[model samples]
Target: MFFLRMTAILVLFAFSCAKKKEIYYCPMHTSYTSDRPGTCPICNMDLVKKEDHSERSKDPSTLLRTEADGKMESKNGMESEIHHASPSNDRSSEFFLSSEKQQSIGIRTELVSRRSLVKKMSLYSSVAYDPELYSALLEYKQAIQSSGLLPESSSSLGIGNLQLRLRQLGLSTEQIRVWSSGQRDPSELIVGGKNGRAHIYSQVYESELSIAKPGLNIQFKTDVYPDKEFGGKIKSIDNIVDKNSRTLRLRSEVSDPGHLLKPQMFGETMIEISLPGLLTIPTSAILDTGVRKIVYVQTNPNSFRAVTVKIGKSVDTWSEVLSGLEEGQSVVSESTFLVDSEAKIRFGNNAHNH
Candidate 1:
């Protein structure tokens, strides 16, 4: 009798211990496991396994969280009555996509002729001269020399070592003769003369001497005649670059006279150095993410997928697809962002789907 009582007591104690321990269930993931847990292993829901007949069914519709108290309640209502509240509703709420839809805004661009253009950088520039005072000095020399104001010995004063002395004394041939000729008004000569003779300097810019350097080719378009396209190849580039601006003054000759593009016009340039069979893609097909570039490839009419890509140089409307893509593959061009969103949600990212 004593042994029987002891065994019974031991069994009762084990049963009581098991009953006191709690279990857990995940709210979002119901298939995960927890042992002696307070919350679910996957979803953090309080796990309650009841022995009652009402609590044993796997029908998700029978399980509900009552609004009055935060606890799971089970009941059997008409199947049609709770059809609106399925697990799909939970997923829909989690991936709220109403705001993720693409806007109807349009991006505007001027289309250029389809040609093989090499990408290049172009900048707006101004026209300038090196020296401006030479014209004034030439006039001063001619006027004084013609006025015949100097002595006969001075008449032959030009074209020798003495001309250098005359120049140095601020006495141009014109200024000395304007005084000797007893001219009523010699202010122009006087202005040229100053106190003594001096040298004058000037600069000119008739034809382009900088942009036409040998072997360099440039294609340009201007905003003034935005529709017109111009092309040129470099004849020469100045060996001395501008110290202030650091620009290599180039001289280029346009083979086609139709490209009489004016100076100081805003333009874009391209230099095409062809490499054989470089992989490229239409720029329209790319989708830009802040962190990584992406694109959507068409798997089927109703299915698409998002793929991250590495990109290289871009020219006009095409981009160099470095990786994550292959040649001859089809992609969503006009609606890539919209399709990528849908693909992410379908593939279980829970991201917003457009």
Candidate 2:
């Protein structure tokens, strides 16, 4: 009988010692933690029990706990904290987090600012070979010669239908006038091999027609001479888009001093467009959810709101923001996926992060 009593006493003592000490703190002044619950000395508000998030977040069915959401006053005039799990019935793009949880997730942010943007386009090009185009140039050359001066100021009566035929062959009116001035020989269209000039044919997709204009400089690289790059300028762009391919044809003139470029040869070309003073952000900051773009803005110390934004051209590390975000706004830049995961857990299928 005495042994049983002694064992029971020992177990009771150990259990008492292992029990976790209760902690309390004023919600308005969280820095003040205490062993006993009462009014806080700093904020003079009633203390509330501190919650352990590890115990709360483990349950997948749990939504979110709104701490200090409201206060209920007692007969003694001391208030108590109310923490409740909210279903978040309405569609809201914002999510809130406590200070400690924010640190654990490694949340980072950057300001949206105006910066100069340079957009680059990469395209596959082929050295051109068109006998039809050569024939048209031959006719244009004869018309110019017959007119003697083929005066730029004169009407097109001397060329007959040759001007229209040249247009159909992709030569702009400006190019026809230049050739008639006797400066650049039109035979270069067909016999450029002797003069060291190569015609290159490349097409741009319909979506990029905004930047497709004549005179834009381009750089070409060919497999024949892997170490060299040739410079060229756009001579003409077709007025019509190819129905089957949805692409606009582009014709360019390249200088081949070493006679290295040959007809029907495969090559690559790059076009660069420089834009100034545009609102931009780090390319990785925008989240592409397969449809719309979303970015998180920190509205408070531990709060963030998801914002849908329209995407624009990207240059280097920065991407242009057409609409949605304003200059000098803070956006989440680092560890965005982790923050998004937490938001998904809180909102379930109703997440509007995109």
Candidate 3:
């Protein structure tokens, strides 16, 4: 009986002890549980309570201690010197230490400005005959010639009759006299008319034709203002192509609001249209890496970071900043990449805590 009672009491005591012990487990890993403080099997991290005490401590109102000047303060504003970390110069340290200093790339900058001067380029074009219009004009001339109103050959009539033929062909009296007196211009007779001759000037030059549109914008410059601009709207496109140049001559009539532009003066011309929402960046702040463009951003004092960027057309020296940048962020404009390299060197030198 004594042996049975002792065994029963020992069993009850063992059960009580087992009930008093607490179990701990990792919040992330439910499979890991332990009675003593130790790491989880899978994660190899110290097993923590399933419910986190750090989570409840996050509320500012529940904070029990405050720190000022590197010292922890009690609920009562007591002051104590904080144990400041010593400067480290460990070169073999592996983990990253986020410090106050940041690195960045240096770059150049120029503000956008407007000027009166404009760059221009010149183009040489020739006058051409418009087959359609030429055919029409020729047909009209033939109708009158075949009707006997105008003689095909002015030599068929006497001088007076020739004069009459010249008039019929749409030639003025002056033109008829010039034709009859063939000593000066023999082709004058070519424009002879029985009624009136339509004077034909052999050296007549017309503007290029706008095949795309009946009318087009004409921009040109003349010798008067070698650097000024003159622009005009297309009056009409000649329905002809120059046989010599093989290009349709287009005539653009531009208005001279400033009247600085004049006729017959040679100048450069350009065609441009509007396209919006294009990305751009400052050209001065860029570092060209044979394959890509780069810029150094001032991430923090003494820290410049190298970043790649896309570039677009330049407005003067200021380049259109494209991707890899945000507005209002500061960047090192002058030698920013060099600055970044220097920063990296400093960081590597100070990588180890000192």
Clashes of each: 31, 0, 63
Write the number of the candidate with greater lDDT, choosing between 1 and 3: 1
The sequence of per-residue lDDT tens digits that candidate 2 reaches over residues 150-178 is 56545366476788877876779988777
The 10-residue segment of model 3 with minimum total lDDT is 195-204
Question: What digit string (tens of lDDT, one per residue) describes model 1 on residues 172-232?
Answer: 4554354345452334222332232211111112132322235666565556656765565
TM per candidate comes to 0.33, 0.62, 0.32
Output the worst ten-in-a-row residue range by lDDT, candidate 1: 197-206
Ranking by TM-score: 2, 1, 3
Worst 10 residues of 2 by lDDT: 82-91
Runs of candidate 1 with Cα error greater than 4 angstroms are: 1-214, 219-276, 347-354
> All candidates' lDDT scores?
0.45, 0.74, 0.43
Model 1 Cα displacement at 82 (Å)? 23
